[model samples]
Target: MYSRRDERNRHGRDLTFSLLTPEDAFELLAFETAERAWFEQHIEARKEQFYSSHGVSQHIIDCLALNAQGRMSPLLIRHKGVLIGRANLRDIDGENASIGYRLAACACGQGIAQKALKHLMKEARCMYGLETLTAVVSVENQASRRVLEKAGFDAVDKLPDHARVADRRLDCLVYRCVLRQEVECA
Candidate 1:
């Protein structure tokens, strides 16, 4: 049930975020199809069905179920009324959750990911009542690491052979942000 419209991108376009809904299946499928190759390079492999409309509809339903159970927040990121990305606060455990985000290829290098992440973090604290957020980034993915750092996450550890991507075991850097301090200070 999350929704916000006040955030904006650098280009002065409105940046909106909302909980993923069944109605978003089409746009989600389209975005996934368009960015599949770009995203696959950085993220874990997805099932073949994930790029299809039926798969996306079921995914949305599952996300909504998780949201209803207070286990996850799957948010759709939109810029100027168009889907541009997604931000998720997943695997909620009490006051903590794991954060993940992805931006469309066309939206990369524009600071949109960082901006959207910052907004998502705020929502995670205020709306979701989360106190801490964790993230894991591939060591080879410098851009994503930078985004996490820029969004105020502190690098905490490096795990060897942490992530398996495309038949390769890659190292990963773990990051954590204490949201309670930020919220209290604000």
Candidate 2:
């Protein structure tokens, strides 16, 4: 379990980061439901079932299982004790992992997501021993692409028609970052 509780002050707002737990189901559900349309603009939409209590509980359970097995680090971003966003490192295989994050529309334009991402990268290096990280963003999501680039990720590839959001088919941009330089062997 990622048992650390971290507090960060951004623009006079208190931001908290921690591992997702079963206790987070209710708040997560509310956050997801409230921001579903906003999120679908850049990412795929969740099934209607995902807004339910049981569905969210199951989602939390599955994520925690992955966390315990060292395959993922699913985190919650809270502001003033409410679920404001999510940042996670997924598919942690060997020395590589992919990152994904989302923030409520109200949280946009404040650099909060970028800050949380940098913190996740720190945990990726120190706690998980990850050396490389990759991220994907919709080509239309200029905001997210900017965040990834601002955090030092380089655009490594592009996929045509990679994802569908609402009624539109969108392309995706793949980004990569090297967390550390590997030592040369004698």
Pick by lDDT: which candidate is best? 2
lDDT (10s digit) by residue, model 2, range 47-150: 88889999999999999999999999999998778788999999999899999999999888777888888878888888888899999888989998898898
Candidate 2 segments exceeding 4 Å error: 1-9, 181-186
Q: How much lDDT does each candidate structure score?
A: 0.84, 0.87
Q: Write model 1 residue lDDT over 1-186, tens digit each, in one string.
A: 322332223433567888898889988998898888888788887899887888998899888899899999999888888998999989988899998999998878777888777877887888778888999999999999999888779999999999877778999999998885556325
Which ranges in model 1 have alpha carbons more than 4 Å from their true place?
A: 1-9, 182-186
The candidate that wins on TM-score is 2
Kindly provide the TM-score of model 2 when superposed on the true structure, using C-alpha atoms: 0.90
For model 1 the TM-score comes to 0.88
RMSD to the true structure for each prediction, in A, is: 5.4, 6.5
RMSD of 1: 5.4
List the candidates' TM-scores in order. Answer: 0.88, 0.90
Model 2, position 25, has a per-residue lDDT of 89
